[model samples]
Target: MGVSGGSPTSRFECTRRLSAADSQCIWNAIAEIGARVGDRFTSNVPLFNCFGDHKMAVRGLVSARPWVADDGQEGGGGDGGIMMVAGYPSLREAVIAVAKKELREDRVSREQALQLMKEWLQKSQDIKNGRLDDAFILRFLRVKKFSVPLAQQTILKYLHFRNIYSHYCRQLDYLEPPVYELLKSGYLFALPQRDKLGRRVIFANAGKLDPYKYHNTDMAKAHLVTYETLLEDEDNQVLGFNHVTDLKGVCAAQMTLWSPSELGAIIKLGEQAVPMRHKEIHFLNVPPAFRMVYDFCKTLFSEKMRNRFYLHSSLEELHQSVDPKILPKEYGGTIPMSEMIDMWMKEVSRKRDALLSLDRMESQKVMHSYKPRTTTPKASNGITSLPGSFRRLEVD
Candidate 1:
């Protein structure tokens, strides 16, 4: 079941009831989203999956996608126009609708949400985000179901993660040797176009790397760099993203290059700090002899992420989960991984100066550790809040 919306109200002397047509519309929208995401969308749906406020919210999310015609002209029920999952005529309308519905449920208004974001940004002690606009904040709000406070909390946590990883976060210059090695390695990439559902697709070529040249930490950091940069796109923030990794060359030996701590950080970034929706994940071309690799690697993912992971033995097998049309030619699809990587690298090059300047940019004051004002019956009654105060204590 999708997320339930806020409480509904009764009009004076009357109450509105859902019509049969409305129910059917929701069903259609769900089916379409399910199709666009290659069934993962439906598979991951909440168990209840019944018609209710959550369905309405889900509908709004669905309708946020661009529509199409069966024959490429015009489609059904859309009245010759695009229909979102929520039955809106356009993505903008659907985002607005979802925003309104979510805020209403959270007991917050649009103005309040906007104000809360402003206040959160103002209080940020770490590196200030250059992207604190309504649209950016709205992405967090959407993920948190428009709960202004929760969204604010998420933003703060993300900033803290950036502060700690400032070298990669602010100082990374894509053209620099460290970063360039990553781009040339073709270890990670994003497609130029969205899938049928308007979600961005990011690929991690697990086998593409030469493990001996660069440490696995470099691979992990580069992957984070690519994803973080892509976060600037509004559509990716809203519609969300899909991930695929080629496991063709990954082996136990390659695993030895990265320490457990580095791997944990990557997982944390994916499951916690990142503010984007992860709709699905695919592991393609998994080699049969990679059992040791699978056993060791699988447990590292969170249950929710693990549930989304699909191991496909072959390209044809993967087509069952992802549309082959959207994949690269190496996997029997349209685009070439080489081309995608090249284009993405060029994008990184274009942002080179900005990325380098980030390292030099002052981060907002972020608390490295917390001492509560109360000692929980055994702690200090008065605690000191230290933001960046601990930085001086770090040795080497």
Candidate 2:
């Protein structure tokens, strides 16, 4: 029973502190719930008494409720659910390292920068339900180059994106059945190795997408889980990442599956919402048919992003920009695609609690109060521009 942290509101507590048990069963039970070294380990080990609607079990902690609702209520039943607390000392070290890096690059210490940001953010009506933790605020500060006003606006845009697209963005649980299936299916994942520039490589196979089996919302949630997990690494935050999607064998059915608005949503998320440095997006083995969709989507990209966008006819061409050593064997690298996917899955499992805790960010109050832009003007090329403000907004 090597358990420690919990939510302030959680009523469960032991009258006496439980010592770490030197039992293999205890370790195995903890691992089943994807617990990290510092995560609170609570299980039915026959030694600790169960309290607060949770009955003691013989085997291990179970996830009775997979989804945490908008109002912070756990859905489903069984023993009131085993709560997985999220924290690790190494993660704190990583955050410190990132803050130092920002200081080195921008000559502004994180302490000074965040102090200024905190004053403004405290008064700002944006991010009503989100945590403004040091690490979280540092993410925006680093990306915006310590410009408090810019960082604040970016945070607002991110929240607005989530509110406007709550249907797709809400309750993005990695362990959720559909998202988990997509994660294990290798539809999208971060490569085990980084590119030559030290950027993370996000690989996707369009051929693997089963439109009939999974909805657009499921795909959105899966992508969110994968990207959010990748961004947790401080190195990824600084160096950013490359996106490579293999369009080989993609049929008309799969291409047509994403409606124009859905396509706009994807573009908006990558370009405006996420506070990540997206270095490049390479479309490998792209067929002639995809050109139509590509051209249409290009309308949504900012000029800077349009410059970062690339199209590759073969692995040879892709290798010119990205290192071959970072790619999977199918793309002429040493490791197999399955192995890369397995590595990503293990990383996801390790961060399971943190990923699940993202449920708290889904604020119904924000969504209900959000007002979408009614006028979405179309370009002369006949492409309907995405609604609402983005990075390209004309700021006074």
Best by lDDT: 2
| Candidate 1 lDDT score at position 84 | 31
Compared with the true structure, the alpha-carbon lDDT of candidate 2 equals 0.59
Give lDDT per model, in order. 0.56, 0.59
Task: Give the per-residue Cα lDDT of candidate 1 at 103.
Answer: 35
For residues 1-396, write the lDDT of model 2, one tens digit per residue. 223234222312321122345223433443444323222234433333423323322122222212221223231111111332223212223334444564343435667878887776666554444656665776777788677788877777776677777656667677889888888888998876655544567899877877556666777788888877766554467657799998776654443345566677667665677888888999987666557567777888888888988998888999998878668898889888887777677667656666566556633235345333333233222232433222122211
TM-score of 2: 0.65
Superposing all C-alpha atoms, what RMSD in Å does each candidate have to the true structure? 15.7, 13.0
In the range 273-369, model 1's lDDT, one tens digit per residue, is 6777787888887665665456556788778777887788787887787767667787777767686666667555544654455444344566673
What is the Cα-based lDDT of residue 238 in candidate 1?
A: 60
Give the TM-score of each candidate. Answer: 0.63, 0.65
Q: Which pairs of residues collide in model 2?
A: 3-41
